[model samples]
Target: MKKKRHLKKEAKIFLIGLGLLIFIIIVILIIPKKEKVLMPLFVGLKKEDAIEFCKLNNCKVDISYEYNIDFEKDEIIKQNKEKNSELKDNEKIEIVISKGINYQVYSDNNVNELGRIPVMMYHGIIDKKSEETSYTGGNVDKDGYQRTYEAFINDLEFYYKSGYRMIRLADYINGKIDCELGKSPIVLTFDDGLSNSIKVTGLDEKGNIIIDPHSAVGILESFKKKYPDFKVTATFFLNGGLFNQKEYNDKIIDWMIKNGYDIGNHTYSHADLTTTTEEETIKEVGRMYKLLKSKTNKFVNIVALPYGTPYKSTHANFKHVLSGTYEGESYQTDCTLRVGWESDYSPFSESFNPQFVKRIRAYDNDGNDFDITYNFKYLETRRYISDGNPNTVVVKNENVEKVTPTNLKIIGY
Candidate 1:
């Protein structure tokens, strides 16, 4: 009977252990399993894209942007969330985007990359001589050139209204057209340094230098002062006139450098590079270089061939002009300009050809005032649309009619 009692005790112990095991199993079943997913890498993704990415994964997000020159604007520069975490639905993910390189950066024409820049070419600005002069005088000689002062003012007003802002040629070449100018970049290139181009006279009664408000420099300055964003700057290809004014040349060059403008070689006597001997090319180009450098104490690294000829000169002298010894050190022109009557591709765009930087004639083919109005409309019809990723540039309405990037991933794009 004692043996039977011991056996019974053993059975009772076994049953209690089995019952505890069953209870533990029931508790586990009652608890729901946590759904898990691998977190997507959002670095370099645009903000809109990141949001979409999170949503697809059944996750929520908290997003922010900080100014960063290294990363493209609205690009996901950082993230706080850990990847592949097993979590319940609606877990919050923190994303940080870049505020862009130029954010909060003050600029004369602080602007964005529209993937195209129009460099407008202007010659002379003179008062109308007579009723027969009409806007276009057929005399290509001394007196008949460019447009009337009234016409030039109208051009500026139109540009300002059309959301156009000016930038320097060097600025464009170096891709510094990243300002918030509320418009596309328009470069004003005045060929031939006319007396009226700058025309700074005596000082005012107040001691401020008296500027001819109608001169190219004066008008640009006044307009820029009125609308600071317009940027008081231009690229003047120099040969004669003020540039050759022996007594005033030094002063003018100094003034130009000090006032945030640029000067380029138009060949010493405006010689056509195509027809001129290589020696002439070098002499004409080099003379200006030496003169300009001596005055400004800076590298004169730009040239606009007189007639936009001689894109390629077989002579070594031409090469020297393009890139040769200056002040015992090597210097070269960044690019050359042509009398191309068309808009130039944005330097930032892939389509931009360094070999050919085009410029549109500011005056109409008929030399009418405000002829640039048509060019304005041309730029409006199709413009550059930033892809949020600066590395990728898309010309809107050209290929895709009208399309905004969505669900974008650069890996496949």
Candidate 2:
């Protein structure tokens, strides 16, 4: 009986050991397995290439763009991920791309800009249109070689209303084409140094000096106030006697220059260079240069030929028309003005030439085709429109590129 009990106990021990072995095998089978490293590093690759590369590495990509002059378009400018960085599979990497140069629209008020500018010339301002005396002569189509005061005032109003802003000759030449806000640069030049041009005569009831409201200065000042955008400056090409017999000599020149106006030489006696000898030319230009300097103590470097003649006589010296030594001052002109009846190119334009600058004659009721009004009507479409942005340069858009950004925003002159 004892032998049979021992056998049962041995059997129970064997069964328990087999069950524990099965439990150990089941636990090992249910546990998860360790995975291999799948992360990859990506940098300095093109966006498309990088994306594909990331995909190969089981990663993702995100993008953004910004204007850059130094980088080509779509050329990967920057990437958020470090080169050879350990990125997890399906992880997103951010990248930045170059967009070239950017731009903002120039706003419009009454002002506009042009690739070229038109310079208008006025000779004198006529105070009375009803004056009976009529004088006719060379280059003079009528009795009075000027615009009537009322008409002159009206012209200023018209131009100002039409978005024209007067500018100094120096400003134009220096590429300072942008003037007051919402206005275009237009040059106003008065040929003869008529006493009445900048003079103020008579007095109001308050004893205030009453400026003739129709005169050039009067009209400019008044119009400037009315529009507040028109620049109150002009170039007065002075001739012999410098407003001869005018009570205010130095005072007038000083006042004009002080007030932003500029003066230029028109010869000592209005002698035509085409008819004068080389020696005579020097004397004419030289003497006047000295005289103007003594009067205003400023550089008199510009010349308006007497009778609209050439700087050099047809039969005289062959030097540059703008070159000369007047009074040991090396009075070389910065630019010369022509007695013109046509509109001129913008000073800022690449095609503009300082030597052959033209001007348009002021218009009146006389009905001459060459008058300012006539030419203005003919050249209306050519007027400049100031694009609000002064920094942008106007140029052709055909050759535009990312690195070479141009100022030209709008088309047409």
Candidate 3:
């Protein structure tokens, strides 16, 4: 009887062990195993090929893009994983694709390649008609320094259609022409900081000063909304009376800076540098600089000469205009602008000088010489056509010698 009982116990133990083994096999079969994959060389491959490889390996692909001068568009520039490395199925393989040569080339007929840039000078933006006002085209003054609101709007539209983009004066001096491909860069500058230039009517619910829709800045903002790519911006050269709005002066200046517009030194009291003595010039330039620095933290170190006097560098007080001290505060100027009647040279040109810049008056003269109509007609073949890359200076093969020597790559075609 003892032998039979021991045999029954052994059978029961064998059945329990067999059941446990079957359960283990079922669990192993139910759970999916992750398949390992050997990463292939994806760098330098075409983006499509890399994606195909990822699909074949049962992996996912995440693509990023960057502008590259060396790699062609859609070519793989870099990969996240190392070549021949181990990866799990469905793992992401991040890759960067090239955007093809950072610069674009336009047909020779479409682009002039490093020609002149137009730096237009403006004053007031009034809302009167030429018949009502003594000035032409509803300008505020007989000199045509102040442009009428309607004419100003028309000018902006003309510029937009003509393929001209607005750039800051500071950027122009720094040789940073950041416009679209094949488009020319133009600058708009408002002198005198008139009440109509950036009029602040009142405050909104949020306490933001309301910009008059009929004002110059207001018109610019409206035009910017109409054409998103217009890049409408201008530099407002201010005197001691910032925009002539004592109540909203601070807020207006702050808003202008916060926006894309810039503020430059128009000299305190608008003193003409030619007639002023060296000390007066220093005080004029310095006092304005100090006032602007106090008003805003980002004051542009540029001065637009009042009345465009002292046109030549030989003026005795010219150095003082460039740099001077006022009441223990020393100030310096990057460039001085003249009330010019012609467009300035390209920043990359050998003749370019930031210290002295020229401007074309924004006025109507029935297409007379030196007017916008005549100048632009002349610039049809002479305007600076961008190569779409700021880092490189593209020009005609013969004009290569005219390019200023710098770290910027020069390409002649």
Candidate 4:
């Protein structure tokens, strides 16, 4: 009897141990596991790299950008979590990105913040004089669409002396003006992408292109050297021909973009949008955009309308010009240009509509009817003068109502 009792006790102990092992397994399966990882060093990395790391590590990321001098733009300047710190996979981390010394300040008090800005439009820049051509007196065509090389130089001098600094058309449309204090922002745009605009001659010994010194790009580079603070830049609206240099087209485009110039869509064939159906319009705009993207990744989503057709947005195919898809790829533009004759409103103004931006004809007409001279004279008291602070829009007390509601702080004096 004693021997039987001993065996029962041993079996009871074995069953209890098995039940405990099963209970432990069940508990482990039911309870959630706490997963953790050490935060990697994120500071000094590019913002994109840090975000990508977070995306793979199952961590949440918050980012903010600020003007930083020490760090390059888009580089991570700071991080909330330290390197090697234990963090739950779901924890959030905040990072600050550098905007690369984009801040400026000035104490001038005479800025006219609620005024118009000039978007100057130019075409072919020929190395000819009036005596060489049977056109008007100035170095321009009779219609003034083309300006002589000498006349173009004179125009640059006029703009610099008149306190106008060059800004990209894209920046102006986006309201990101970055000129000096008391200076007005001026946008330079060249249409047609003519040979004279950027003529690439034979390559040099170093295989670098030899741009004709009198070409539009050559003159602008020389002027930029003379007036470094002018921030001399222009947007060249190009068709598929691309400055008409079939062999050196890609090289010229790459050079322009690397040198801080902008390229925009002028349609694949310079198709007049008003004459085309909706599908045709999309193809024209989209094909040019796609072609540019294929050449360089830095495609500016702005189009200079061919002949400035469909001048209003009410046209049936106008929306297609703004955004559309062609052959499976989609394209969108932020603003459209007209063969305009006057200055456009300040982007901060309630009257500003990026859908249709006007431009001034950069030609000589004896100061007549919306030409360069006439427009500058008209803008003397009505120019959008910089307040030296891009984060705020300061205007006269009477113009407060004209300020557009924005995230930017609005102040009226």
Candidate 3 per-residue C-alpha lDDT over 1-413 given as tens digits, one digit per residue, 9 for 90 to 100: 99999999999999999999999999999989866788887777898898788778888999899977667788889988998899886898899999975434545435554599999998988876556676666466767888888888888998989989998999999998888878899999999999999888899999999988888999999998999988888999989997898999999988998889999999999987888888888889999999999888797999999998688988898899899889999888999999999888998898999989999998877788587888899888889988777777778778889998878877666
Residue 303 of model 1: what lDDT?
A: 80
- Which of 1 and 2 is ahead in lDDT? 1
Q: Residue 406 of model 2: what lDDT?
A: 32
Error at 274, model 4, angstroms: 1.5
Candidate 3: segments with Cα more than 4 A from true spot:
1-68, 71-76, 80-104
- Superposed by TM-score, candidate 2 places the C-alpha of residue 394 at a distance from the truth, in angstroms, of 1.7
The residue-level lDDT of candidate 3 at 364 comes to: 79
Q: lDDT tens digits, residues 1-413, model 4?
A: 99999999999999999999999999999999866678888888998888788788888889999976568899999999889999785789999999975434322446767789999999998888656766654446678898888888888999999999999888888888887878999999999889898898889998888899889999999999999999989999999888899988888999899888999999999998889988899999999998999999986899899999887889998899899998899998999999999999999998999989998988877888788889999999899888767777777777888898888766666
Q: Which ten residues in a row have the lowest lDDT in candidate 3?
A: 102-111
Compare the candidates by lDDT and give the number of the best one: 4
The residue pairs found clashing in candidate 1 are 110-179, 110-180, 111-179, 111-180
In what order do the candidates fall by TM-score, top score first?
3, 4, 2, 1
Looking at model 4, the pairs that clash are none
RMSD of 1: 11.4
By TM-score, who's the top model here?
Answer: 3
lDDT of 2 by residue, 315-372 (tens): 3432433667765665566667777777777654556766557777665434466665
Which consecutive 10 residues in model 4 have the weakest lDDT in total? 101-110
Query: How far off is residue 10 in model 2, in Å?
Result: 78
Provide the lowest-lDDT 10-residue window in model 2. 398-407
Candidate 1, 202-235: lDDT as tens digits: 6567644456777778777888778887776888
Query: RMSD, model 2, all Cα superposed?
Result: 12.8
